[model samples]
Target: MQDRAEATRNAVLHAAAELFSERGYAATSISDISERSGRTSGAIYFHYTNKEQLALALVDAHFSAWPSVIARHDATARPALEKLVGLSFAVARTFRDDVLVRAGARLWTERKSIDIEMPLPFVDWITTVERLLAQARAAGELAAQAEPSRDAPNLVAAFFGLHTLSDVLDDRMLIEDRLANFWLLLLPGLQADPAPRALLARAGGRVTTGHPARVPDGTER
Candidate 1:
């Protein structure tokens, strides 16, 4: 019974995420999620007290996926410059493929009137990225003057800039192509080594020569 209830809850979240992506948070109705998930509105209410709570839950789920993705590329295993470059590319790929992530990215800037407290999970994700960049600096992956906590926000802004522009440039260059180009251009400022050039080339190849991951169909994973 517990497993079944959990499954139902997940189903509702999955449906809600899809609807929220297609229609912004303010526009998505609880009834839409109910119809999409084949569940009653009362079931959704049982799982989440209200739409605001549901939106926060979706944000939490999306942010939770970042740490595991970052962990996959250990800073210690690779040159710091390479690690930083790899992290950028990995994050771009993750962002482009995940609709919930895309939606959450949109929401982070646009959300209003939620009355939520500090976004602890998001703060933690940013801190972890900063830590990784700091590790890269300590390991001589970055310039001696490099500071991750101070600089990571700029890098994050650059990343979002690329993401935002990718949609506009989709006709001129594929989103993956734009992501590679964006990273290539930004990496030089972060590192003092020439290896970033090669890494950028490899990343471009990975995107242009490979296929983009399909957009996620559901949120259960």
Candidate 2:
């Protein structure tokens, strides 16, 4: 019975993620999720008290596995800058292919209407980037003028903007391309050696390459 109940909950969450990604949070309804999941309202309410809770659950599910992904990548013993570059591609792919991630990101953008607290997903992302940038600085991979505290937030802002644009244009590949271009443009200003073109090529080569083990029991592929 517990396993069956867990399956039902997953089904509802998956259904909700798809709807939220397609329609945005304000426009999606409990009934829409029910129809998509083929589950009764009672089933959904058993796991989530309301739409807000449901949306939060989707966001939580999307982000919880990210730490594992990061830890695995960090274990590769690569340069911090290289690790950070690879992370960008990994995230772009996730946003492009993962429905729950898309839903969580969309909810973050529309959080005002949902009246939720600042999404932890972005917070965690920024912190990870900050740490990577700091490591890059310490390893002498960055320009003397580069400040990780300053640069990390700016990079994250650019990433957020690019992802949002990708969502709006309905073009996932655009982000992959644009992020490459962003690295090309920014790395020169960041790296002491300023091998922007070569670094850009290397960064591009790393995207969609690493396989962080699947988030267990989550609806991600």
Best-matching candidate per TM-score: 2
Which candidate's lDDT is highest? Answer: 2
Q: What is the lDDT of residue 54 in candidate 1?
A: 80
lDDT of 2: 0.78
Local accuracy by lDDT, each model: 0.67, 0.78
Mind giving the per-residue lDDT tens digits that candidate 1 earns over 11-92? Answer: 9988887888767777789999999999999999999999878888778777877778677766346665566567676776
**Steric clash count of candidate 2:** 0
Those runs of model 2 whose alpha carbons end farther than 4 Å from true positions after fitting are: 115-121, 204-221
Per-residue lDDT of candidate 2, residues 1-221 (tens digit): 99999999889988999999888888889999999999999889988889999889877877775877788769977888878888888888888888888888778778889866655556677789989988988898989999888878888989888777666654464567566766766888888788766665665543332232123354232
Consecutive 10-residue window with the lowest summed lDDT within model 1? 212-221
Error of 2 at 61 (Å): 1.6
